[model samples]
Target: MSTPTSSSSSSIWVLSNIKLQFFARIRRFLQSKATRKRCEPSDRFDTAKNKTEPDNKVENFETVQVTEKHKEKEEEEEEEESVIMMQRTVKMLHFGSWEEKEVAVKEIEKLAKEDVKVRKLITELGVVPVLVSMAVSPVNSRRQAGLTALIHLADGTYTNKALIVEAGILSKLPNTIDLVDESTTSKLAELLLSLSSLANTQFPLASLDFLPLLRNILETGSRSFDTKQCCLGALYNLSTVLENAGPLVSSGVVPFLLEVSSVKEVSEKALATLGNLSVTLMGKKAMENSSMVPERFIEILSWEDKPKCQELSVYILMILAHQSSLQRKKMAEAGIVHVLLEVVLLGSPLAQKRAMKLLQWFKDERQTRVGPHSGPQTPRFAMGSPVNQIEAKEGKKLMKSLVKQSLHRNMEIITQRANAAGESSKLKSLIISTSSKSLPY
Candidate 1:
């Protein structure tokens, strides 16, 4: 009986301890689960919201959104404001008082310069016609303001430029440019420069009003060279059209160009126009008529520092000299051959090439020269001549021989230079192998 009671009591104690350990393990698992849940965002929000049960628990159901679409709304607002401003500007430009019109045009000019799109846009508002009309306004300040606006409107857009011409700016020009001051004259010249591109198309830029105004400004010694350069640019553009040549020459542009091209400041532009005119019959004839032709041009060719001027001058001479004996004789008498030799020695490559070609013509003239000869002629022998015919002829032949040899030597030097320039062997040999006979004359 005693052994049974002791065994039963021991078993009961062991069962109670096992139950307590199992409950502790369950409690540890539950604590770990609670810690992990609290680490989540929703659980943290719930814990922070309220210590009062489910009533104070937080749940946010508001739908969230990114608000970047406001830019489209802002652009729409800007567009509306721009339209209102343009309408106001156009109204003020069209029917406003002189002061209002002046203000409007300046605004147009400023707007046009901002963007090409703005230029095209403002042009659609009919600002060009009003600006052009104001260009001819008798009031000098109004005129300058108008011209300034048009120049900006016509800046880089071809369509805007075309619209300006189509607005009859040509017809509206004041007959007397002298009525305007130098500042207004300069502005007008700049406008013409911008509008000169119309000459390249079918548009008629050679109206009676156009060339006269250009000539007036260009001829005025009081006008600055900057203004003159702008006028020259206009003249050059107009001269590009073949039909404009007759009127250009008839306008007495040749004499003025000859006078101005001598000045180094405007020489290149004036010469370039002369080069264009030289291609036309009237232009060639007009230049030939000028006492300044080969002499003025020959003087210009000596400008080594002004290489482009030299090039243009030589180009005009080439045109004038081709198949024209009268001009060539005048050139020879005016000491053109010496100039050509100088050009051959010291000039741009294109200048050198052109000079050599002109020289070849003179050389051919020398080789085939008969009674009244070519190259550069010496003084003639009278009937009772001091120079005996045999002696003179022999001396002439010997001098020709020396010249020929000197030409051969100079050509050899040129070949050596070509060699040093890293030219191809075939070209080098072609130059090197050339005999004196192969030289001009």
Candidate 2:
């Protein structure tokens, strides 16, 4: 009995100790679960924050692309609008009333100035013909507006120039140019000048029957200064066409040009046209037949106002003097030798050179005529006597003085060339020696 009681007590004590250890383990596990639950929210918050930043960046990138697309769309719309406006303006130019046409033309001129597309569009719409009609309108204001519009259109575009020419504008130019009013003629001349610039248009212009009208206005002296200038400019431009050279000379262009060559405003252009006309054989013959004399050209050479005019006048004279003893003798009588000497002393370098060449030509020709071996000879009166020897001696003295002057002038130019050549030779030698020393050999 005592052994059984002892075993039962031992069992009871072991069960209590086992229950206490189980409770302690359960408390520790609960504490760990609570700590993990608390930390989970903070960790998830950090992950969500990181994901939101990239999402924001991606959204911003998409927004930028969308903005660019919108900008492009807006620009395209504006360009389309501008094209539509231009097309509308071009249409209005055709069917509009006089007042409406005037308004439309004014607008057309403005648009034409801003863009080449507008000019091409106006031309394609056949507005140039209408403009030409209005250019000759009975109403002065309408006529002026039409001319002004045409001028702007032909300002820089060859297409517009061609369109204007093709619209029968050249056919009407003669009649319109004959208008008695100074203002009318001025504008007409301006248009003629513009049309004459193109190679293809030049023939049509030359074929016109208005050369007499142009000459009349230029010579009449009744036209305003500006009108005369415009007419002069048109003639100058027309004279550039070689085919027109004959008609220009026949229409009295040479005499009028000579008459106006003294006017400072027109002198340069007048001389230039005469110079161009003299290039053609036909033109030279016509000029020689005209009332204008060679003495006028010699006088021009002496003018101190314009050096270029003097230079060009000398050049034209040089061209005329070739192969024409009559012209040469006339020039010599006009004191051309003295004038050339003055040029060599005081004119521009180019003028000086030309003058010297011409002088040398004269000298050579004199030597050829007199026979190179024959020294200066005495002139005989009707009888081969010494009565005219004094006259002959004076002529010889004059000839010697001219030769001496020419030699002195040529020596100065030759010395300059020699010095320049010597310097260049020294420079070349220095360069060669320097290069030679730099080479390995």
Candidate 3:
């Protein structure tokens, strides 16, 4: 080792030479292997493997195309079957026996539910008039079939629904809601619910025709709970149109709805319908005339679980009480102030808001009726009408007597219904303390 650097450089060059020789031998071996055309089993297998590898992507794409075509053909066949079925159904519905018509409509009902496009197609085939004709049939089975199919077809499109109505399907409804079975009543109610949407459309439907049927269902007890709800839904839909309110009130729909409003299961829809009705003059008068007006409504405000019902009850009360001294007097006489006090403390935010608003109304109403200095006043301001304290001490005693009697009666009403909101003591204290300024709101 003459020098350490020289020895290391020579060793590195020898290692590089060994690596190059190793790669050159591997290259020579691969070239020889490819050049040999020997018909060995391994050579045949390798060639076959190379040929198969490129087709995988093409095969996957071809498979997708085949699947798409198969789906299209299946759809075409289903459409063809539906067309043939509809054609046969039309023929049977028109010319066949009632039995045949029943079977045919059942098929129509099935097909209509499957596809709305098919529903439109079926109606265009004049099946609507035929179904409408079937709906008028006296045969119960035949009638239900037609109505069931019409309900589905009405669901098809807006035009189809209008056609169903224009064909006078409503007039064909049983004059009374009672049918041979609950099923018929249920289906008919459902059909009415579906058709009631037409009340607001530009299309002129006989809105009055919907009233008697809905009212009968609501009035009847044999009808199932669900069926009555359907009629209420239909009635509610009809009430949305301003013009329908007059017929609704005249049809005596208010009292039964007032009855239903007390039922918690169906209370909200019933309340909403009443709310709609209350805005109209006829509707409001009808409600105010009912004995259930503020009393039934006042009880509803105590419902801690049904906040919406509470709110609606309060809203309807507000409508009745607005500038209505008689109605406000009735509410005060019904012990509403106690219920309202409970709501102010325990009701939902929205309910609390409405309750507070109502309280203000009653407060103002009370103040106006009996101003702070107006009741049992000793001094007289000769300008205004004088029922002052000094002018009438006997009147002062009378006022005190009336107030005591009222507090006693209100306490009884509040106490009886006071299981949950039973802290009438708080309400009692407020009422007794505030008697001079305002007895209660």
Candidate 4:
């Protein structure tokens, strides 16, 4: 009786081991199939077995099998969830269709009110493409939402900037830079600032190429205030990414910036960009490429409508002073002294003081140029050489005319400042001092 029981127990053990091995092999096969299809192993296994295995098979194990209808239902639910999430994300963008400017405005207002939501969505889903689309949309709400989103994005943060780049959002920059709508243009600038705030960390070479598109935007001049401001900020940030961008700075980008610098309200930003650029060799080289930089700068100093432009111009010139004494003389020759006087005349005593100090620098020994020879009589190239003499006279006359125009403009500015004396008395006094010093007694 003992022998018969032992033999029976051994047979049972063998059968159990074989069953376990067969199931293990089946599990491995199912796992492989699931991996190939990118499906869940447990789910796919149950799915495959239910379709192939018969319900009437011998009751050998307790494995659960899922139905095909149940699997389809789960997939549909997942897809529906994804769609809802996308819709919510798009809503955060706030840009309405082209015919709906008012709706766009309202959406943007709502988005601004939902700053925390905007931040979260952007950081989580990288809604850069959505924001860019709003910028491209003709509706005011779209533009406003894009701008506000950017403002929220650029509050000196790192992760927000990373989201912008990761979304390949900069690729859309060329289109935004080319946009002509005022609201769209302004939002584009904000986008630039947001991208720039990313700095060396997130924005690398792949992202840095967008700088040239910005150069194009500034060159185009259809840009609004916000647009130009944002371009300036991006450019300032780009200056920090110098090595990979040597050609961009050298390729007339600086001249475009100098042109923008002549604008009154945005000139300070442009000057700041230039100042940032000067730190890089490529940027200094770019300045050399701008045939009219020194001259353009001088012209900025002379713009009567904007005293701040003049002040900023002077500050930038002063910074460039450390570059080379030759640079100072070159700027002086380009009419910087006269421009400073013009600024002083339009400003208060404090402005005047700043202008006078700059003017004094122009009069510095290093900045002063000695003619080939000096005498009360016009220096002749050589005796009986009328050709050189005539040319020399013409050149001198031109210089004198420029200086005279500058001096005359400065005097006029001083007169205006004196008349206003409205927060500009200091500027008025400085103008008077500079005009007096510039004119021959």
- What TM-score does candidate 2 get on C-alpha atoms? 0.66
Order the candidate numbers by lDDT, best to worst: 1, 3, 2, 4
Name the best candidate (by TM-score).
Answer: 3
TM-score of each: 0.70, 0.66, 0.71, 0.52
lDDT of 4 by residue, 279-384 (tens): 6767766775567667777777666566666666666666555435667768766757666655554554555666666555444333233333320223325678
Q: Clashes in each model (backbone N, CA, C under 3 Å)?
A: 0, 0, 3, 10
Report the Cα lDDT for candidate 3: 0.74
Stretches of candidate 3 off by over 4 Å are 1-75, 369-441
Q: Which ten residues in a row have the lowest lDDT in candidate 2?
A: 432-441
Over all chains combined, what TM-score does candidate 1 have? 0.70
lDDT of each: 0.76, 0.69, 0.74, 0.59
lDDT of 3 by residue, 62-146 (tens): 5755665566557656645654566677678766888898889998988888878768767766678889887778888778888
For candidate 3, which ten residues in a row score worst on lDDT?
Answer: 371-380
Better of 1 and 3 by lDDT: 1
Clashes of 4: 10
Model 1 misplaced regions, further than 4 Å: 1-72, 202-208, 366-441
* Root-mean-square deviation of every model: 28.0, 31.5, 24.6, 19.9
Which prediction has the highest lDDT against the true structure? 1
